[model samples]
Target: MTSQEEIKVVLLACGSFNPITNMHLRMFELARDHLEDSGKYRVVKGIISPVGDRYEKEGLIDASHRLKMARLAIQNSDWITVDEWECQQPEWVETAQVVRHHYEELISSENNNDDVDTVRVTPQLKLLCGADVLESFGVPNLWKPEDIEEIVGRYGVACITRCGGNPEKVINQSDVLYKHSKNIHVIREWVTNEVSATHMRRSLRRRQSVRYLLPDAVVNYIEENDLYSEESEQKNADVILAPQRYTCTN
Candidate 1:
C-alpha cells in the first residue's frame, strides 16, 4: 500500500451540488472504505467537480456558491477536498479532457520538487458516477466510446449503483472499458436510498422538509438564501430540465 501522502485517488464526484446531501457523503465514505479494504492506498481523497460556465445547462447556481456548499458539507471529512480547477477553466470543456488534464496536473505536482527524500507519489484517479449517468453512456454524445477508453487508460474508474438499477448493464456494454483499465471497480453496497437534486428542489419549493435529504449546513444555507422557493422554482422551471432538452437533440 502506498503511504498517505504518496497515495492519491481523485473522486470525480461532480454535479450541480445545489445542496450537498448525506447520500453524497455516503458515496464518498463507501469509495474511501472500498479502496482502503483493497489494500491499495493508505488514504482516499475526494474532489468535487462542479460545473462552471452556464451555456446550455440549466439550474446551475454560480460556481462559488456550489463550491462553498461542497466545502461546508465536507468540512469534517479530512479525506474530501473541493476541486475548483474545472470551474476556473475557460468555457465548454469536454469531460474526457477535464479528466485527462486533472491527472496530468496531479502527476506534475508530485514531481515538482527535486528532493530525493520528498517521496513522489503516483495516485490513481477514479471518476465517480451514479447508475443514471452510466446508463446514459449507451448513447454516444454524453461520452463517446473512444473517449471512455482514453479515460480508463489514463486513470482508474469507479461507480456506485443507483437504487433499483443493475450497474453491471453499463459495465458489460463497455468491453473496451474493462479491457484497457485494470483498476476499474464498482461499489458492492447498493444505495437503496432514493435521493435526487430535482426532487429536493421541488420539495423545497413546496415548503417541505429536506432534513434527511441534505446535510445540515446545506439545508440551512438553502433556507437562508431562500433558494428554490415557489417564485424561484416558477422562474427556473425551464432551466431545471436543460439536460432533458439535450436528450431530445440526440
Candidate 2:
C-alpha cells in the first residue's frame, strides 16, 4: 500500500504486569510485525497499561512496582512505553475504558499541536492481548457483552495465539465476536516462548533462577526489594501461608 493509504495504528495492552516478563514485551513486537506485514497498517506506538491495585488479581502486585518493572522491561524499546493512567485510577478501570481513554488522549494531543505544517492522521487504537484473554470472554459474566462489543467491534483486537487456547474457536463460538471477526487479528507466535508472569513468580517464590526469563534490571529490582520471597510473603498480613499455593504477585 502507498504511504498515503496506510492506516496508522496504536496497540494498547492492559493487564497486571506484576513483574513484566519477556513474553509480555514480546507481544508488542509480534503485534507490530504482524500489522506492518499486512501492508495495510503502520504501527505507530505500543502502550502497556498495568491494571490498578484495585483489580486484586490473585498474584498481582502493587501498581507502583508493576509500573516500574514495566518501564524497565521496555527501556531499550524504541516504540513501546508504559502509561500510568490506569494504575493511578482510584478504582479498577475496565479494558474498554483504558483503550478509549488513550484513544481520546491521542486525538486531544493531535488537535492541540501547534505545528500546522505537519499533518497527523488519527490512529486506530487496537486492544492487544493473548489468546487466554480472548478465551476469557466465554467465561460466565467475566466480561459485559457491550464492553466486548466496544473493544472488539469498535477499537479492534490483535490477539496473540497462546499455548492451550484457540482464539479462532473462541471467536466463532460467540456471536459478538463472529460479527466483528474481521476486526480481530490472531497473530501467531512462531518462536513459541511460553514464558509467563505466573511461572516467573513461582520460580521467584522457590528462589530459583529467572535469569533470562525477564530483564536483568527487573530481576535486580525484585532482589533489591525482596519481593516474592517466602519471607516477604509471610510478612504480608493478608497473605496466608498455604502449602500448595504461592501467594505472591508477579
Candidate 3:
C-alpha cells in the first residue's frame, strides 16, 4: 500500500451537533493531520452532517439552528463544509447511509467533470467520529450488526481518541470492529479537550458564559436566539431532554 500513490480521502462526521463545539471542529484537523502526515492519504475534504430533527436526542435544538451553527462554525475553514442533506431529510437518517450518500456525491461529481485528461481516482469516504461514539457500538441492540459492518467494513472510520476512552480496547472486544480494525484509524489527542454539546447545553441553561468553548458566531447566535434556556424547554415541552446513554465528551 505504501508503494501506491497517495489516496484521496474525505472525512464525514455525522452527529447531533445540537450545538457544535470547538472540540467537534478540532476532530477534523486532528484526523487530517494524522492521515496526511503518514504520507498514505491526502484528505481533500471535511464534512459535518448534522442529524435531522426527527432524531429525538436529548438537548437537541432545531435542525435549522444546528445546520446554521455548523455553517457558521466552519466559515473560516478552507476545506470543511456543512452538508445540509441529512438535516433536511423528513426523517432520521442513519450514519452508514449518510457516509454512502456523500461517497456517491463525490463520485458522481467527478464522473461529470469535463476534464478528461485529469486522473479520476475514486476518493475514499470514511466516517469521522470520537471514541465515545465508537464505544456505543458495543451496547446491546443499540446498533445493527449489518449496519456496523457496512459502515466500518465498506466506508471505513477515522476515530479520534477522547479522554477516558480506550478505542483500541473497544475495537478488540467487538467482532465487527476487530474484523475491520485496519480501517479504523484511532487518532490520539495530545492536548485533551472535554468540551461537549451536552456540557455546553448545561452551561447555557444556567445562563453561563460559553465564549471560548464555541465559535464567536455560534456564541452570539445562541444568545440572540435564546436557545437551550428553561423557557425554550417549556415552549417545546413535548420534547424531553432525557439523559443520554453515552457520555459524549467530544
Query: With candidate 1 superimposed using the best TM-score fit, by how many Å does residue 4's alpha carbon deviate from the native?
Result: 9.4
Clash total of candidate 1? 0
Candidate 3 lDDT, 1-250, residue by residue in tens? 5635899999999998879999999999999999999899999999999988766664567889999999999999999999999888886676777887998999998999899998888899999998877998898766767778888999899999966778889999999999999999999987978898878988999989999999999999999998887654454346542212222111
- Compared to the true structure, candidate 2 yields what TM-score? 0.90
What TM-score would candidate 1 get against the native? Answer: 0.84
Clashing pairs in 2: 18-250, 19-250
Give the better candidate number (1 or 3) by lDDT.
Answer: 3
Global lDDT of each candidate: 0.69, 0.84, 0.85
Task: Evaluate residue 214 in candidate 3 and report its C-alpha lDDT on the 0 to 100 scale.
Answer: 99
TM-scores of the candidates in the order shown:
0.84, 0.90, 0.91
The candidate that achieves the highest lDDT relative to the unseen native structure: 3
Q: lDDT score of model 3? A: 0.85
- Candidate 3 contains a number of clashing pairs equal to 0
Per model, state how many residue pairs clash.
Answer: 0, 2, 0
lDDT of 1 at 220: 87
| Residue ranges of candidate 1 with Cα displaced over 4 Å | 1-8, 234-250
